[model samples]
Target: MKPALKHFFDSMGAYFGRPGEESLEQLYAEHPGWDAQRGRVAVYGDFVRGHVRGVLEKIFPLVRGAVGPEAWSALVEGYTLTRPARHHELNHLAESFPAFVADAAASRGLAAFVPALARFEWTDFAVFASEERAPERVERLTANPTLAVLEHPFQLCAYVRTKGARAEPEAGEELALLWRHPELLVTYYVEATPSALLVLKMAVEGLAVPEVAAATGMPEAELRGAVERYSRDGLVLAPGGGHG
Candidate 1:
């Protein structure tokens, strides 16, 4: 908060946060003798940028693998310069990264799937970190509190599983159901069918099976079967006594 400290940080930001040739000159002009300390300032910038890239790499390993190292590094640097740290927690650094990737993918001429992949990866991390819990029982059908429905343009689940062995993903419009396991407290996902997604989306709004069937025009028997399957998989909170 002191003026001197604030000036130092601002100078550092100019060096790392801004691109082009004049950053160092601006830093040197701001504080005399910083020219002598350019090496130290460069090292400090590398250290901070390293931490940002490391956290993003951990959060979006799939995105990194898909884009390859050169593009990944450039993307990370772009993210660092554009989306400066806003949160106290390091993990929160990635909160805006998916949106960043969306813009970068377009301007940088990256693959179409890149944005979807980034979103999928971030959603996985978010579901893992969610504080919401599934109730033991539901009077009406209820979705898991941590459940997130993601509709992606590629087979993200399988693509992430392959770990980038495949150069590109299989292209298709798909729905993925991401949630934290109530008992294990780990994130899990399943590619879902349109009907199943519809049921779960309705259930998230507190619709009972019958109500969902009526609203969607699905047969009650079929809706009940789907509800039972979802309940067994912990996508829907089950009834107290049983899934009756």
Candidate 2:
């Protein structure tokens, strides 16, 4: 009920499991050495922390799984404290984790292959809920929509590619194409080239061959070739074809 205690609880709730400090007192009263000043500290929250921690843990499981328990806990501590998500929806919350990996991989340091592996896994669920991919392909690619459906807001995601035909980490910012299909399947793949990435992107965004070709400075025949490549890869599909 008190502000200091309330503040402590809300902070705890962010990391723990409660609506506020009052809840913390009620829930964690039996814990060792619990007091007014240290109502619910980081360690306490970790014991009770749920959704966000669970999601991040899944993302970095390979990193964690490879390292085992003690080391993984330490890694998780770094991620939860440093890269907290404010959004209520946990499924698509790892949008920032890729960027966080970039920072940690550079500064705090991560297990080798972590940055690439994390980026690949991070965007897996997001493509479905993302705004970039159009919902229900246009019956007529050229005609205007009568109901005025808005193309979804896009999510910027990254992917990894093998170097020299092996799982070599990208030396720099890797070019990737991530988009949701009508079936809500989020797919990721390494872009062969910048042009290839851009062309594939345009294809997934529901751009027609001509528009994409004009925008990308490729010949229609070439664009068709690229679209077919995307189709072969199962990244994009024919208009009248089934969604997803």
Say which candidate scores most in lDDT: 1
**Model 1: per-residue lDDT, tens digit, 50-121?**
777778989999888888889998898889887466567888888899999998887887999999999998
Per TM-score, the best of the predicted structures is 1
Please write out the lDDT profile of model 2 over residues 68-138, one tens digit for every residue. Answer: 57655665555566535556777545567666665766555455556555655655455445555443543
Cα-based lDDT at residue 172, candidate 2: 50
lDDT of 1 at 231: 67
**Reference-based lDDT, each prediction:** 0.79, 0.51
Screening candidate 2 with a backbone cut-off below 3 angstroms (N, C-alpha, C), the clashing residue pairs are: 9-21, 131-152, 131-153, 183-244
Each prediction's RMSD to truth: 4.2, 8.4
| Residue range with the least summed lDDT across 10 consecutive positions in model 2 | 143-152
